[model samples]
Target: MAQLSDDCFAFGGPLMSIDDAVGIITAKVSAVTETETLPLIAADGRILAGDIAAPLPLPPFTNSAVDGYAVRASDLPAEGEATFVVTGRVPAGSAAATPVPAAHAVRIFTGAPMPGGADTVFMQEDVRVDEDGRVVLPAGLKPGANVRPAGEDMANGVVALRAGQRMRPQHVAVAAAFGLTSLAVRRRIRVAVFSTGDELASPGASRAPAQLYDSNRFMLMAMLKRLGCGVSDLGIFSDERAPLAASLREVASQHDLLLTTGGVSTGEEDHVKAAVESVGSLVLWRMAIKPGRPVAMGIISGTPFIGLPGNPVASFVTFVHVVRPTVLALAGALPEALTPKPVRAAFSYKKKAGRREYVRVSLRSAADGSFEAVKFPREGAGLLSSLIETDGLAELGEDITKVEPGQSVGFLSYAELI
Candidate 1:
């Protein structure tokens, strides 16, 4: 549904910073124009098509915030305990039968509506019931201390959830509370995914001694599904320019976006760049990031295309850093959710200047009760096991050359990305 810009790689030449790349994507990609109405139960993880305004205030009435005695603060003794006649009882889901009079208290339960003249509540434990049907109160109590004002959670006619928001269980609960049986959400994104390499074989299938089972495609499929895309796996394509070109054009015509892992590098077997260029145009390639330097962004017949690296770790890292935001932008949500967070580094490390790096790291509990990121024991784009073992990636910026222990650094969690 989104189109690529003509000068997507105009800034900072061929190898661009992560911020610049994301900026171009955020600016060029337009949200899908289609929408659908679905039942509230079916709207989980779907982007909201329109803003949800509160039909009426939440709770709808002023009520007690605790199980206690509701009484007018003015009726209580200023500095000592006092006894009040028990006038009436009001439990949750029931209204007060009569107005609370001075020197009288109403037995109220949590969520019960406050009596007409009662402005404060004393917890049941703080009060004692005498044999004469009177309640003895404590010396000190704040006015309106245990009261839930009308519309406390939400105000009437206010927007409870804005458009482009992904609906979660709590959001569904709000919709249910507003008596909405259904909601309007953006239609699912249509994605076509494939892998490129003669040495890659399908998982669980027979493979040659030199060939390896393709894990990147399955990982891409799962990631796309988690992002709420309607994915179509196009299987694997060999290193053939003509066939791959024809397939790219055909798939682009049928899907909103085409995603492939491998064949962007300048090698003899790499044909994806050539194919995409022959059919459409190559907008950008070669990001300034470690393990994902070969990532490519382009367009085919008005459909956006992203070519990830062949290595599983590179594919995973690039998808989280680059492709994930592009897909979210196409889905009508703001692509700012994946921004990096700050964390402390437990292990000291050194990196070259002018290239950003994401190191797989596990979180360690420090003696001072704070979290520190420790790099994984192993390294390499081919070692996919590191991803499974690490809690997240510790990001070192292009300007940062060295990190000492306990130093604050940026962190990107796999839990948040997926």
Candidate 2:
């Protein structure tokens, strides 16, 4: 589990920037020390524990990159074309039976090893069979034009994969190509998720007249799964101060993180703030971000805790920025920057100058085939439909006060968040 001083996150302010919050989390939070070995196929999405050195050179041998005739560059006719007796055929996975004599060519398929004494290839489509059944070669063809040299992809004993990388399918392909059967990766971070509020009810449970079904907890769990976390679904607990405080302290030892949605703000009925204070230290961060301004981060028994807002949109937006980084840090994964793609904005909007805002938007192609961002028609943090109907967020930076159509703005796609 992560270790931290009670006052590590002591830096607070009336309004903090997202960069500041992330800086503290990255600087203070220690990655868990445990690690596990897994099969190559199961390594995807896990953090690499150490650098992976190539066992052997990629391709391992010199081979043909295309179906063609292999010949020595010196034997080619200087002006037009020349023909040579068809010496032998080399198929993929097979070696040459014998070296080709001068003035002879070999029929070689893609991935087949070049016959000894051959240093050039003429693509089959670019050459022809002569009347004598000999292979005709084109002039002006470069030697080694269609050959994959040994160690062309990577050399043996070189570091091919680095530590702290989140493994992906492409990375798996690299390992497989290097003949790796297993990999070492950091253990998945364990998380405990729950919610608190008298106005909230479980999805299947009977609801009181003033209660609505809880959505934040379920949404948060889904997000956590995407980050490769092992989550224990601690169902909605009582909002009463004593019970909530007791629950927070009891679960901190078993999990790397304790995550809650809602009940962190200073409301007359809000008990989470006081509840966390009783058992752990809390920092109520009012970030300079729209939709997710009020976020609560704390420490309990050395485990990190994060409390998101009650609003579904706010919860979703905050998860990508706050919870995602914290989870990566805990799992020993390197920081993955969320780089927004620039797209033309089709909607006009205005906002305060000093705060950063993410406008939910859908992208469409413009007249010139470029993508333009279209904002959701309605605006409210509580509207769950806004999240579903939109494709991603349009990032308006702190210096951006007003936006007009045709202006280029940074866009963060939903696919990039995880």
Model 1, residue 271: what's the lDDT? 88
- Over 4 Å off, model 1: 5-14
lDDT of 1 by residue, 1-418 (tens): 5666655644446578777787787678778989999999999989999998999998789999999899999887779898999889998989987899988999999999999999999999888998987889998898888999989999999999999988889999999999999999999989999987889899888999999998889999999999889999999888899999999988887778899888876777678889988998785466889879887788887788888988889899899988888888889975556567888898888998989999999988888888889998877899988999999898898999999987998888888887
- For 88-128, candidate 2 gives per-residue lDDT tens digits of 99999899989878989999999998899888888999999
Candidate lDDT scores, in order, read: 0.87, 0.91
Error of 2 at 395 (Å): 0.5
Q: Which stretches of candidate 2 lie over 4 Å from their true place?
A: none
Clashes in predicted model 1: 0
Pairs of colliding residues, candidate 1: none
TM-score of each: 0.96, 0.98
